[model samples]
Target: MLDSLRKAAGTWVAKLLLLLLVGSFAVWGISGQLVTGMGGNSVIVAGGTEVSATDYRLAYDRQLSVMSQQFGTRITRDQATALGIDNQVLAQLVAGAVLDEQARKLGLGVSRDRVAALTVEDPAFQGPDGRFDRNQFDYVLRQVGMRPEDYLTNREQVAVRQQIVEAVSDGLTAPDAFFRALALYEGEDRTVDFVVLPSSLVEPIEDPSADVLAKWFEDRKANYGAPEYRKISYVKLEPEDIADESAITDDQVAKDYEASKARYTTAETRRIEQLVFASEEAAQAAADSLKAGSTFDQVVAAEGKSMGDVQMGALTKDKVPDPAVAEAAFKLQANEVSPIIKGSFGPMLVRVTEITPETVKSLDDVKTEIRKALALAEANRILLDVHDSYEDARAGGDSLQDAATKLNLKVTTIDAIDRTAQRPDGTIVDDIPESAALLAAAFESEANVENDPINIGSNGFVFFEVEGITPARERMLDEVREKVVADWKVAEVAARLGAKATELEKRLKDGATLDTIAAELKLEKQTKRGLKRQADDADFGRTGVAAAFGVPEKGVGLTPAPTDGGQILFQVSEVFEPAGADASTLPEQTRTSLSQGLADDLLDQLVARLQAEYDVEVDQGAIQRALSF
Candidate 1:
């Protein structure tokens, strides 16, 4: 019951309820506290419905607990405030109060019998026998810190509010026009004729003069700036690093092998085929035919069945399921048939097509494996001790390297690496423990600050310290001349290609054939038919497809190629609408999705109306006091 509640709390409905009930109490400053001096314990008041501070605190703590479980750590009060848990809890309370008030105005009430029925029908209250259990109900409510009467009251209120929600959103469906428009938009297809203009088609670009190159470098110096790098030293402690296979004695291996002998044993199995008959006389007659001259498969065919219908794949004696069949099948040799026997289902003839003998590995065969397993187990058992020893040395004011050396652990030093773990030469630094986490911590840490160790799950821990920092700086033209020249050439090629594609598009618009343009440029002309609006072609690319769809039939446009700086000159040849199928024929999933969207919109509007009608008031001061602890 407790587990079910925890799982239920993670669902979307639970999350939405939390968000709605937890009003913006933290954001509602004392100045906006509408019920500030109302006194008493009420934190929120909607019409005649009031939420006490005790109730608000209970909801806040419940939400906090759920968040803590999700994050796998305890959430502090300050963290909860930062996450707006207080606001969400208060908002939910406010929304519920408003709904309750409106329900009261509408004279909406749930009978005690109805609440009782809902309680009894709840799956969380079911016992192992699948019936409502009073003990389970009491236990689950106690675990969640709710009293019986309080739970019943909350259940009754929820039932009442549900009445309004159902009236507002039930039986809603997406309009036919909206569905048809969506179907048309999603199912439209197009075909296009396009030519890719490569950079080679552009006129040759000469090397820039020294002055021109220098000016270009100056304009884009920031692009060539070197990233900030940090030099760090770290020590890693893992079980594999400390495990010593040689330390595991033969006697220990023998003992472990004895304790887990079943791990090395393989069960015998056989490929058995069966032919069951209505009576012993029929099965005997089939066996006689098989023994005379007919093959098992021929006999099966005579019975209007194939081998697949009779062959039971490999099975161990215990896996045969029928005890009589299992005993008879195991007694026969390969290719040998058993006498007609009565199985659980009927009288059947069994044939053993293949047999696998059981095998057990000797202690000598698995001695080394057992030794390694024992060694790893011992290492894991003592890993915490090694970690503590290192911490003790650190507490004694020892340096990271000194402490690691004392424990006989190696310390790795990274001379200089940027946030991306790249060296100055642009090569990625390799084999760093927890590379990403280490780099992020190294960059955020100062040289002399004592940084916390990164726990790499159960495997190990990595302790790192930033040694030195190199600030980012712009590189001189001389330092990046080769790269700058290559980039400049690319930009020049792109500019020329763009101009050429524009010329080609204008020609196509002026009635020149795509084939003629392709032939003149010595490029391939490609046509893609039945291309949907959302088609993602590798060579044509999405932007090119969009450009094609944007133009009318016979219109030409250009877009940059997905790869390479080349551009695509395309002419839309045809546009096809969806077939004559009506929106009512849409897949059930699509219709349900659309209907759910409409229902959600209706519910949102109803909630807004209720909130306004009730004139919700929040006691910010009361909320602050309630969550102070």
Candidate 2:
């Protein structure tokens, strides 16, 4: 299993370097105490270059910053969990370390020119004209917890990794023959035609003798078992539950609406034709021409300028810059052209062809929007206050009871929630200040009341003391007798079906007709009429299509042995076998699949060699320390 796992892991290393997604590492107030794995176990491996607390902290901050930007808001615990972001962040760090070690071992280094080329050309780091824009790069960097140099270094590594990627993916080609076949398959639309005959058509059979049932039961005891089910009781706290109308007086609402009116109003916007010449004099001349009663498009064509203006709409002040030219353009009434306004590309003329004005809406027109905004604001304020008050009390070393009193929040207890399940209260928690999942870190033996506080979510933190931790135990047969009995019944039925099938096969082997067999069994010789080869699931929902396909025309055995779905009983009516496909002219589907197989094989070989070149020793102690939860 270990060797198999490694082989599978090696096959995937070609894709290992891709930075497909950024990680999330949000930080909440630490309360002056650093908890390791939920069990106080360290969450770090001890090998390689020494990893420090600062490194962890910086990486985490960067992860959170990236997440916040991607989400366009603060990262919630639920959102983090949905992304599995904490784990991704840690894995990002680990993969980087591993690749860095490999690069160092290979004596591979990124040259300064290469780094500069990458940085200057990276669209993320470039301004509109494609020149290196350090300010833009640094602005993004500051948000994600790195300095300019760190970002530059990271870009350098990315360039080196791209080199490796190019080596792996280059020279990968499918020949013309393959391409032709692939195109056909890509264009092919296979049709399937079939009729569905439900089991309700079958007449009911008489009750079986007790002895027969017992005999059938012996061969199929497993199916009679019932499913193991769980009943969970949980407390749900949604935002609307706690809100009251008393908190939102009409006056207060009117004030909020007035203060943020632009947000509530429909925006007046326009799309314009802009022509800029690299030479300022040429641009000014074009602007002057526009002011001489020439149409914008006619002037644009005359100037030999080519870039079309963007259709910017519903824009506010911040949407576009606040320069006088832009401001004047936005202020113009519909169908108006502003006077030539000079700027970087020399003078620029603008035309406004569309405009929508701000209008007051009725309460009915905006009730839902108003309600949601109010709810979100109230939720944020309440949750923030609750979080801050808890932190303050904990910092002051107040007892849990004292803290609860000071915060005016309920002091509550929980039923033991195992690692995989929800907390007794229906909170989907994450990053429990330990390792991923935090299951191993929490146990029943330590969960009973009468201990210290527990850390739950980030701001939704809970300091839980051990209440009662129950060790897991397998269910005894006696405890699940009903389930076992149900399983036994299903087994009995399936066994009987299997036996009937086997007997039919035997009789067919002795040269009995399908019609004769059906007659002997008092069953109809029903068949699918004019069925297509690739019938859909709804068409094949009936049981007998598979059986019809499985019977052999020449012999007693199943024909062709194709399990389109499940057991087909086929007999050859007549041979209408498809012509042997031309390997050279096979459809695009087959050729593309073959190409992918080849590429995968090459990747497999490269990864195998790479792994052979490195020495990896897992420190069991360190791994356990990091993943104890």
For every model shown, the clashing-pair count is: 13, 44
> Model 1: per-residue lDDT, tens digit, 1-629?
12323354565334323333332111121112265666888998887889899889888877777777667799999998898777766766766777788898989998999989988887677789988899988887766677889878887887887787778777778888888888887788888888888888875888889998999999999999999998899988898878889999889999999999999999999999998887877777788998798887777787788888888899999999889989999999999888888898899888899999999999999998899899999999999999999999998999998999998888889888999989999999888888898898889999956688998887699988888999999899999999999889888888888887888888888989999999988889999898878888887778877877888887888989999778898888888888864586577799887887778677666666666767777878888888875
**Model 2, CA-based lDDT:** 0.48
Candidate No. with top lDDT: 1
lDDT per residue, candidate 2, 1-629, as tens digits? 11222233232211111232211111111111222443322233322323333444455544454555445688765676586555554544444444445566667788988778766765665677878687877765554556767666666765664555456655665677655554443333222221221222231334555575555555544543332222212111223433445567666667666777667676555555444455767666766776687777776677665435433444554556536556877778776767666655556666666666556676556655666678666865686566566668767786655666665554544444546545534465443333232334334324323233334444234443443455445544455445445555544444555455566667766777777776665655544444433343343443433433444434333321122222223344542333333455565576666766666566445434443343322232443343323
All candidates: TM-score: 0.66, 0.38
Candidate 2, residue 258: how far the Cα is off, in Å: 36
Cα lDDT of candidate 1 equals: 0.81
lDDT of each: 0.81, 0.48
